[model samples]
Target chain A: MLELKNITKKYGNRTIINDLTANIKDNEIMCIVGPSGAGKTTLLRCISGLEKIDGGQFILDGKQFDPTTSENNVVGVVFQDFQLFPNLTVMQNITLAPELVLKQDKQTAQRKAQELINQLNLDGKESLYPYQLSGGQKQRVAIVRALAMNPKIICYDEPTSALDPNLRDEVARIIIDLKKTKVTQIVITHDMDFAKKVADNMLQVQPIK
Target chain B: MLNYIFEILPSLLSGVTTTLQIFFLTLIFSIPLGIIAGVGLISKFKPLKAVLEFYVWIMRGSPLLLQLIFVFYGLPMMPGIQIVFPRFDAALFAFILNYTAYFAEIFRGGLQSIPNGQYESARVLRLSYWQTFRKIIVPQVVKIVIPSIGNEVINLVKDSSLVYVIGIGDLLRAGNVASARDVTLLPLVLVAIIYLALTAILTFILRRVEKHFSYWK
Candidate 1:
């Protein structure tokens, strides 16, 4: 289980998330739903170690975990726009971090990438660049890239924002199927319909009044 | 006409050697320095960004000819910092500094053109800063700034003639000598052809480079 205790974030003098608290259980899909500017993305950035939370302590399974340390990638984030490296093919994008940061050999990394590609239904897309892929295909590649790190938690920032209704259903199905793989997920979305379709638990974030 | 061309050819060829030396050396040193400076301009350290911005402003605001004169002649006459550079060294020093500033500004814009998601993505993936820069950022920036850098490179080829002001026996200087001595415009015309030829060749290479980078995007 992951715990967020008194999590606070401020941009300049304005406080965005003030004294927030939440609990996310193992293998659970928790969707944080709110109107725009509710700081859902900011909270995700904090957990992903991209943002430094002003007054928050993360306790993961009874251990004081600091994502900022970057000693270990305990969390992975798939951005909304699917920012895959354009210069690299899909397979290279998926395996780059594993080889460079995790010290995995090229064959070991590519083997793992092939497995993720098959699991995510990204077959035969390995040689394609990000610009060459369709929106849905790019998102799947993004998810596979994140999964390659084998993080304990993976967060999605507005995963369905750019998708059509058909692809939205596909995203929902993918999120539900990922639960079977036993990775905890926190999805940030303003689309309540998507949250309801995929979430095992839901939390609402309100703008600071 | 043919005999006159041959007579000036050897002198002009030596000048071409000098021009090419400065052109090649300037690119070799300045491009790498410019990339670093470009990164520095946008760095989180406000002081560094401010300093580099001021530097680029000063470099761009002035003429390359004046800079060449200053480095070669004016510096040695300055009160305390009377460091004298040989004529060739002074021309090279000034040219490198001038081009480095231009390339830095181009790169700064190129770096800015990248999406915020790219940086965030690298961070979330736990990519080391150096790895992120070399593998992800540099490739995109290079692709984006190629056209702009190509313009500067072509400009550099012609601007190499400015070295003549500092008493460097560059292509322009050699042509001037033969023209005045023989009392004919033929050597000067030959000089113009060589300049055009050099730029044309560089333009062709730049187009090829742009094509090479196009493979991804």
Candidate 2:
């Protein structure tokens, strides 16, 4: 279980997330929905340890999680823009984190990446750069890249914003498919229908006035 | 005019060798140094960024001929510093330092052009700082800066003529000497042709490089 207790985040005098609290059970798909400027992205950044929480404690599996001392590889994020490294091929993108961060051997990492690529239906597109891929293909590549890290939690930030309605439904389907694998997912999005389709639990964030 | 060219050809050829030496050496040292300095300029450490900015300011603010003279003559005359070098070495040192400043600015612009999303993605991927720069950022920066760097390189070919002010017998100086000896402008015209040919070859190579990067485009 992942427990966030009294989380507070401030930017100078204004508070973005003030004493917000929530819990995510293992393998649960929790969706956080909010309007713009509600700090949903900031909250995701804090949970991923990209931003510092002014006041909070994270308890994971009955132990207090310390961001400073821990390696903090527990969460992986898929950025809203897909932010694929433009220079690397799809295969390179998927294999990099596994080889670099996990210290897996090249053959092993490549093999695992190939499996994920096949599973995500990205077959035969391994050598293409991010620019060459369509919106749906790039999104799948991004998901595969995140999955290759084998993090306990995968967070999607505005996953469908760049996609058309058809692609958005496709992404929702992909998320529902991933839910079967029993990895926890935290999705931050403005798409209400998408939230309804995939979320096992939902939390709404209100902007601080 | 043909006879005059034949007479001065050997002398000018030798000068071309010296000119080529200085050009290659300066490029070899300055390009890498500029990359390091450019990355340093954007580093979070305030002092390092400040020092690099100051160095760039000083180098860009002065003329290349003046810098060559200062490195060759001025520093040796200073009481405490007492830095001294031979004419060729001094000219080379100045050229490298001056071009590095220009290249650094070009590189810094290339680096800054990369969106913040790239870095944020790397961070969330658990890539170490060094890995992120080497694997993700550097390749992209290289592609973005190639055209700007190519322009600078062509300029360097012309700038190599500036070494003549420091008494280095580069191509232009050879032409000047021959012109004075024969009382004709043929050697000077020949020098211009040689420079044009060199830049043409450079342009061809850079075009090939740009084509190579078109895979991303």
Q: Which has the greatest DockQ?
A: 1
State TM-scores per candidate: 0.96, 0.97
DockQ (CA atoms), all models: 0.83, 0.76
Q: List the residue pairs that clash in candidate 1.
A: none
TM-score: model 1 vs. ground truth? 0.96
- Which lDDT tens digits does candidate 1 get at residues B18-117? 9999999999999999999999999999999999999999899999999999998999999988989999999999999999999999999999999988
In lDDT terms, which candidate is top? 1
> What are the Cα lDDT values of the candidates?
0.93, 0.91
Residue pairs clashing in model 2 are: none
* Backbone clash pairs in model 2 (N, Cα, C under 3 Å; residues 3+ apart or in different chains), count: 0
Give the per-residue lDDT digits (tens) of candidate 1, residues A70-128: 67778999899989999999999999999999999999999999999999999999998
Q: Give lDDT tens digits, candidate 2, residues B122-172.
A: 888888889998999999999999999999999999999989988888899
Q: Which stretches of candidate 2 lie over 4 Å from their true place?
A: A67-69
In angstroms, how far off is A174's CA in candidate 1? 0.8
Worst 10-residue lDDT window, candidate 2 chain B: B1-10
